[model samples]
Target chain A: MLGGQFLETAIWGLPIVIYPFLSGLMAGAFVIDSLAHLFGFKQFEPVAKLAATSSFAMVLIAALAPLVDSLQPAKAPLELYFRDHFPYSPLSVFIIIWTLYVILMFFEMYFDYRVENIEKSKLSGIRGSIARFLTFGNNNISKESLLKDRKALFIISAIGVPLAFAFHGYIGFVFGAIKARALWTSSVMMLMFITSAIVSGAALVTLLYVIGYSYYSKKNVVNIETLNALGIFMIFAIAFDLFLDFIDKLYSFRAYTEADVFHGWTLVYNAGGVLFFNYFVVQILLGLIIPLILLIFKPVRTSKLMMVIISIFVQVGVFAMRFNTVIGGQLLPKISQGTIIPEFPWLGFDGILSSIGLICLSIVIFFILGWLFGWEDSNKNGFENQTNSVDN
Target chain B: MSYRSDFSLKEADEDCNQELLSANFMSWLVKSIALGLGGLFALSILNSSDSADATEKNNSNLPTGPINNHRWMGWENPVLDDKDGWNDWDKLLNPKNLPVWYDNFHEIGKTKPKHHWVMVIDTRKCVGCQACVIACKSENNVPLGVFRTVVQVMETGSMESSPNGMVVTDDGNYEPNVKKFMLPRLCNHCDEPPCVEACPVKATFKRQDGIVLVDYEKCIGCGTCIEACPYNMRFFNPVTKTADKCTLCVHRIDAGLEPACVTSCVGRARIFGDLNDPKSEVSRLISQYPTARLKMSQGTEPQVFYIDLNGNLEGNTSMDKVFMEYTYTIGFNTTAYKKLGGEVDLPKIEEHKNPFKEFEK
Candidate 1:
């Protein structure tokens, strides 16, 4: 029951929110890909190819979210080519970082699939023709060439670990650098973003691995050991993310000036009813805390059904986290106190449809890559088997 | 019979030749006419620029005053008719006709007089009529639901008595006893503008004279500059598709005219001039009055200063009843203001309430 008051918030809408979330997922998936190749984690080896292909698919679709969200979609290229003169802007740096990461990941995927593509090229029809074109006429499938491909992938994955961190960490810096918004301006924002990205990435790849394994092998080849390891990794990442959230709350209570106290309260307590629930209940309880507790149990970690359910919850929770961070930060008026702007429209170009469209588009890309790479035919003699045999 | 047939055939052939020649002649004539017309059209187009210049010259020569019935009506100069016509006519009729402020402007670039432009607003004189806001909107062509300037109204302290002697709240639930004051707000044109720093393309930059401007072409409509501004002064202009804010009326200021908001202010509350010049009105007022800039703790060094500022200017009011009034739709809400009703309850004041009084002992 407030009196005549107007609330002004950020002009950015759902597309901008989805852009960061999708990019975070992409970065997270790539980090998981690096876990097997670069870190030589045996538990992740079985899913490494799956993770790499998923990450590549994610990267291919990452730019669409922001480009579609831009008011002038045609002029978006100017962000890199024409107007990227300012070195101080996090966004300018982001363009360069995102481009480099995409190239590295793309090349890594290409080399990983090169031998298989040459084999597929020897067959007849359009798929073979496409495979032949993809092979770029490098028909030499000698052990030495295959070894070189592995070495190249190892090198790229090594560089990609930091690149993944930078790609997603810079997105956090974009929001954190805004000194105007009280909720967004914090040094811990980048760490929070990166940690949660890992949590979400682990959850998504685990879910994809289970689905792909069941579909391709026609058996419940859900690797219990891999799922257990991923469950553990997710727990740690979620713990760190929650710890940052705790520290942010504590800092608000202790150090905020009198003028900023209301903003701090809005983030924790007085955020409108829906947003409050979204932040506290959905993000913290369901997304972080519940999953953490569930993953701690050996039975839940080993159980395929249980792990899949927890991963789904963790992803939902991560999405809620992003939603709250982005949309919640913009609810309160910058100058006025005790008033909140209503949520943005859920329909239209900037709303629910566009977000759903982007996700659907990403799925389409994932399936297309799956078909092209013969993901379903896991029995096929390919790099994954070769790499597994070498590791053994 | 054979000779007669040959003669008739020759005659028929001659008739056919005549018809073909006439047809060819007609087509040639049509082509020649079309070619001549196209050439004339091209020639006219090429000479149009010269004609345009001549027309501009003709416009300048036209009488400055309205035409009268007599041919020589506007030809006579009023200054020339005076006694000192010989000495003053040339000066008075000069096309430049510079305003008095131009002398001060010319002096600025010549010696580099440490020019730091500043604005001083006397809150005591503001009546909340919003002339300044309207003037700025028209001057800048600000779109609806966005403002280059705004007037913030903060009401506090109940009045002792109603001026009309009949006190009634709109809802008739309580007495109308609110003491309200309007605070005019615009871009402070801070020395360290966060918006300028946040621009990825350097589209928005602060000029040497302290006015910040946006290069619309380079902006790319990122809206990051709008996000970085603490005061919420910058907004996306749908017309230009770029972030825009108050330029301090730089166009007018360059020609030695006061900002439109300053000129249009009904209360004469706003004063604008170079802060470096001690003789400037803004400088004198700053020295004479106790003034404060908004959000000084942020260290932006805002150029817009306020005098007699009161009632939670820093937005640190502890009163539970005070709520901000925004007269336009913001975010997703289309309602003009959130539920406006009931008399504003004023906080009670304690007599002899100074916390520092005990410390003095």
Candidate 2:
């Protein structure tokens, strides 16, 4: 690679990529959950428990990516917190927003699982005793109290959705705010991130909803209408996301805007480069377009198998977009004329292995929470059979 | 009962589907508008973060040293003049307005500084020597693969009409007719240093004397400062796990001696002095002759000025010339100094936790 003098060797590697991918899924899933609780979309209610629980899990894992990425992982967050920080710095603001969002997620899950906890408290053994403890002494499962819980859920969803947006949007701002990097200086970065978050999050929730419902009920049949609704959201979200990327890239060209100082547009546009493959081929073509096409057809949208495949592609695209932003932006030297190729981080604390570990950890946590609280059983007995009553 | 999963979109009445569609449309309409508005609000704040009117500069949020009056370091700045330009409807096309490039002397601090530091380099007089670069390394104890200051050997004109002709190396990719000049670069210690603004943890800050230093204990080793510098002066210190850069030899300057680089310049190409004191050599040289600074378009307000530059610094990024991707950097400087019969053992300086603590008698 012909790079200029002193290309930055401390390139932020794959951990930063996983950070946004997970956070987007976190936010996007919560937004989908909001359609039912906040907006009274009854058809979406069956998937609500699955979406919210998965969102909670994503947040837990997403939080780890940055901590692992920080230079002094142990010391860095303390300084960012417990010490003075500039409001202009997005990282400073994100910590506060993230904490609030985490608290919000916990409350949302509590209200979501409250009735099940009340019911489980009646059974014998340690599980019953644990459920009794989680009920917080208010064992009432009356309609009024449940309606009150519904109102509370609505409020939590309202705040949760934007807080989720803030969490993911702040990540975008961390890159976009840097005026020197031509590739990331796009004003539309936050919009692109939010839109893509919706796309990926919806896709993941759809996939999880289909898969989780089937696994929990020990049946292949699930709610087709709810799956179609998620699919519709996925299609629109992906379309809007693609439009944002188009605008971001189109204006980033030197011909369109003055901010493309080092020809960041050219690097991504260059057919010969890795960034071009990440941005154009994997991110735009496979990740977004393919998923959008797959989700658009009615048969595909309703088919549980097809939904899972499209969601995976959507995730791939979102991850590639993040890879393009964080890694691609660092390829060119700030002071020199040439480009620097980053060594792939296959090993290390924040390497690809740790990322895979983090994902597996989140999945483990998700199931443990599911087993302890019976999130699957609640969905199955409560809303599951009723929603599944409709023919596919 | 309403919260229970009794209602499905099986559309009860014939009109129910239409009502549901309108309600969903309205829900999306409100959300889309909210998202759009939130984005605009964010864009407005971020673009205006560095605006001039952040007077009293309370928002900078640096923990140590009072960085008050240094916000734009007084109104000789192009960026400050356009502070209100963000509100103008015509200027809405660009909220992140670009700053016009210009140069002027910034008095070091609000209260008169006991000593105002400044540097003026005579690029014409520089003999492409490695003296200053070697002295700085040994004095600062800059680790391997990095340097505090460097003399960038750059070229002008085409590969043809070459001065040295094609190198004796047969396969070398050499540009012909390219006239080479060496430009020495270190920390500019800008009046409104961008690194200070970029740090999230308030690790890097500019002192009253205009010497920018990193609080090593405070630094998170984020590498944002290294990118913020236009001069490429900052580097990640592998030893300390902190960001390292030229402090303009703040330690030596405090001891009433010249910087190591200044003392070692065989050609006396680098000049350093108190610019506030009009009788100083730096002040005299700047007033006497026309001088230019590198990358003024960046609006960092770099204090280092160059004389007889004569198109040496234009039409290129930092360090213009590249012969086999080689610059007379730290390793090469150490080798050249040894060839010139310079000694190896230079004293190692301890890292200062707080270099800019108020001067005590």
Candidate 3:
């Protein structure tokens, strides 16, 4: 989809600047999981699961997103993939990692899901025979196999974390590189993208799981302990993201050229008054702060329903944050100096709206697949089918 | 025994068709929609190109001229069609193309300096006539409405009088007496440019002689360098679908001729030379005089510079002024039109001077 968008821009002169955000979201999801899992944030387990699965699904969608907007959709990848000059091309790097990350996530999920069937088959003679057949007739669920899976997950996630950062960070770096425009120019942008990715990922997974549990089990299995812990993490990530943006704008506002000031104001305000206040205040205060307060409050943190509402708000906030960073960053006009004046129609609708719709649709598909694959399976029964001894 | 059999049977059912079914449906739906949307997007792009061509034909009825009057080509023609000397709604979106002869005629270096060509725009001589902007566009086949260079006017002092009998400013704004001057700015083409460093794929790069250029083909339209530049010079060319900025007329400079802006300076205020050569006019001016670059402290190291920038016309001062009030003192001087054949008594310098310097500290 991303390739198509690029192709469209190259061919049709599409005015939309939202293509990078969609791709950033894809890689950003996995990056969030790597942070939670590696740091051993058990409260982030729900977030981790959501990030892993959403990123997994988005990888497939983002790969095609650019193509949807390109003139020669088929030939777009050839620009980077062709062996003539493949090495060091950023697109080539992204394509290679995108493929690797998706495959790694797929195998990780497969290995994880197979364990459940192995345990179920152990209960009966006939059913055990069937479970044995289903799991390639293997019956090992010992400490050795568990240890191997744990190690594999750790290694992959370790490597995947940086790759995920590189993936989303590359997008920020791309925009920041343009010195012709004062609005998009900043060294801190890539780091901002990476940090925000964590924010979005943490919020997304927590919200999805709570909803998933409520939808399927009807008993609110998303524990308050998990929600409270994840909510706290969300606040930290969000605050950091906001701070970086403030520093960038404040520094520019002091000495901005007329064009820079114009662009800067557009970035901060847009046609709709103060761009951040509308999206960010709601995203931060209502989405992050309220939930954070709830989690900190003794009464709300213990309630499953309250926790569920807070998680939903957090996830929504994260999405809005991405929208603001990606879209708001580009809203500023180029070449502002002195008393910066706002200009443009610099942004447009076509690509942004289409991408949002497509991403939502892809997410819906991800949930349906999760439902069928039994995403709710507990670890106790899922590990028995491993042929090798389990450890860890 | 029965429970084990049932569990195995369920596992078998899931593995056989249930798992593949969900995955396949998702893959199919996503892939198909993606393909369809992708195709539509491509078709629309192709259609836009065709539409532009058609609009070009219809643009003959339009007013064809330069748009923002800046040196260098813009992405679109300056014309918007009119009916009976009024606005023509149909021609607003339809753009016209440059003359065929304008394409590829002057490849630069053919008639001008081969490399390291530079220009010094003397603000003292500039009358804000905008001749350089017009001359550059016509000479370089630049498109209308977009400027590769801009002449900004800085006005300082206030129009109001203070309570004292003296002609001091009462209103705080920089409008008194209107001591205005024009600063024509273009690509600095810095030696260590921030734009080049910010580009992820090296789409925009600095030449050996310090001219920064963009390769339209290689650019993915990511707009990274636009954000990197503290100077807002780069513009997104919607037609070419790439980021563009001034290249200091490298092509013209390479042709062994002066840049359009330099040659077009009617008052001879603009000077072009090779700073590396000690004999060069620019080198002579820089070594012998007080010259200043735009935003020197930012460390981009811009090649462009100015001379005789008055005391009130220093660096950016808006932020400092908000925190404190500044005091300005006026002084008088006489510049004789003829060469002074004899020494004349000069007025004593006033010790109680302007207080602008305190803000910098």
Candidate 4:
């Protein structure tokens, strides 16, 4: 609550929070995709293709969220193109990693959809023509070529796992490395960010899988085992995330705000505080606790409908975590004991409305990618199986 | 039988509605109490923690791991990296090392600085005139609200209104218990600036002679630097749409003139001069006085040394109206803004249905 020389308007606002959450979702989805290809988790097989597609869509949207947050969005390209962009700056590191990662994801998706693209090229329709153009005419559908595609995707996922971690870790470091901020200075910030990212990513995949499968399948009954595995993965992620929270909270006890107030106790956990609700209720209780409790019961985890609801709660929880870390960190000024109000502009480019628009844009991209890639055909995905035989 | 059935159905609807309402109220009560208990528990913990001893001083045990790793990271400033990149701050604090401090600064080919700039603020002499504040605005075209430099009045509770029937005068010290005084505040232009490193684009850079400034063209206004600055010196300029901060009046310094704020300082409290020349007034005063810096433990190593400045600046105060009138807002104080020669016209206030409109004549 250091009310010193505080800004009238919050500079980071909702966009900053949304940017990190979206990117985290991207990274988390990448992690799930990799779990099947890289880590040999057969349970994650069902969601791998969906995860990759979602990851690609999210990366684009997450990247744009920052541009919206920047005052001079036009100059954002200069971050990469500008000569002597400071190499060590977290933001600079993020841009380079993000670019490389996006390209790698594109390649992975290209390979995933390559076989399908070739199959469609034989048909007589606009989608087939479009598929032919998308394939770039190297459409060798021989058994060896399918193996080669699988090998390529395998290597890409391997490389992408660390890159994905680095990409998301950079966002955490961007705030965590700031020596001036009391709340953001903890050593565990990056780890916490990564874990929470996995939680949100896993949850979103679970939600989409449940909903998407029902939409695509004639029978309402879906893969209960996959949903259970996702729920288990989420529980572990949330538990790890909560443990980090515990450590950070205890460490903050030692830290002091610039205003001579307790940094952790006053701003973070104080009951009447705005940060309190964001941290405890939205983030911990409804987001993590209740969801965790529901998922622990065998009855809830086995049910697709219940898993969907839990996934929603997890996304909301992770979102609150980001909101708390970004906006809540800036609310308390460094000068003295008081807070600046975070007046969320519901309109304007930098407002909450714009963030909602960006999210919608991401969903639209997901739908477009699904249509373009012919993902409605269940046999088209599943990287390992697709390489085994050609679908005629 | 039909009449009895209708009556029973109506009774069931009423019972169901009442049950739902009670359930809603009960859930709300349970949730509120749960959250409230967490807050109360937190408050009690805070109280217990506050009663701890002297180690609870501000910035004690401050975390500075990333800042301390410049040498390890091998990311030292290329120009000064080999021999003079890092300085032992404790060594520089000694007056005997003043010449050494000036020697290594800014040695680029044929462009080495002759004078190392430092500004010393004497808090005892500040009268809270608001002249420096106004002069800075007029000189820099600073917008209606924010200040590049402003004087803050720290009221020490020891001050008495009319103690011992002694009358307070312009030049007289009437009350011995009085501690009310003005402490002029501005950017310290820190040696180990956190803002410079945090800036993603390196838009903010520290000059050879200790002046840290922002390159407006490169700044994307990510506000990373704004958060990095512990002193709250950096701001977003609405006109430029980039990050802005106090530049130590480098333009005027190059022009062989004092800063607008320094030139207009009536009390002569602010003395800016070269640390290169030991005979300079700034060097002499700094050597003589037991000077102190704010939040020194944060390790920014602030360049502005304050004399007779007690570190008890009480805060959590509301923003003053003048400070509240930032340019990014829909409207601002026209009367106050005109003083600074603001050009923007007043925006039309969106009419609202007044709650007391019914009583209007």
What is the per-residue lDDT of model 4 for residues A198-272, given as tens digits with 9 covering 90 to 100? 999999899888888888755223567777888898889888888888777666554433432254357455686
As for lDDT, the candidate ahead, 1 or 2, is 2
Q: Find the number of clashing residue pairs for candidate 1.
A: 0
Scored against the true structure, residue A183 in model 3 reaches a CA lDDT of 51
Model 3 alpha-carbon drift over 4 Å, by segment: A1-49, A59-107, A113-147, A165-196, A216-276, A302-304, A316-352, A358-375, A378-392, B1-114, B162-175, B310-361
When sorted by DockQ, best at the front, the candidate numbers are 4, 1, 2, 3
In terms of TM-score, the best-performing candidate is 1
Model 2 regions lying over 4 Å from their true place: A1-7, A123-126, A216-221, A259-262, A372-374, A377-392, B1-108, B161-175, B310-325, B328-361
**Clash statistics: count for each candidate:** 0, 9, 96, 5
Q: Given candidate 4, what's the lDDT at residue B37?
A: 95
* Candidates in order: C-alpha RMSD to true structure: 18.0, 14.7, 14.9, 21.7
Candidate 1 regions exceeding 4 Å error are A1-7, A216-220, A254-258, A267-274, A373-388, B1-114, B157-179, B315-322, B326-361
- Tell me the tens digit of each residue's lDDT in model 2 across B1-361: 6644335434245236334544665677799999999998999798677554453343456442223232122212212223332213124312233221111224344456666698999988888787888899888766555678888665566554334566545554554666667778888888867777777787776666677777665677666666566566787765555678887987677668899999999888899999889999999999999999877777778889999874636423433343322443632222223444545443344434333334422
CAPRI quality of model 4: incorrect
DockQ of 1: 0.14
Q: By summed lDDT, which 10 consecutive residues of candidate 4 chain A come out lowest?
A: A1-10
Kindly indicate the candidate among 2 and 4 with the higher DockQ.
4
TM-scores, chain A, per candidate: 0.91, 0.92, 0.73, 0.91
Question: For model 4, what is the error of residue B306's alpha carbon versus the real structure, in angstroms, after optimal superposition?
Answer: 0.7
Query: How do the candidates rank by lDDT, highest first?
Result: 4, 2, 1, 3
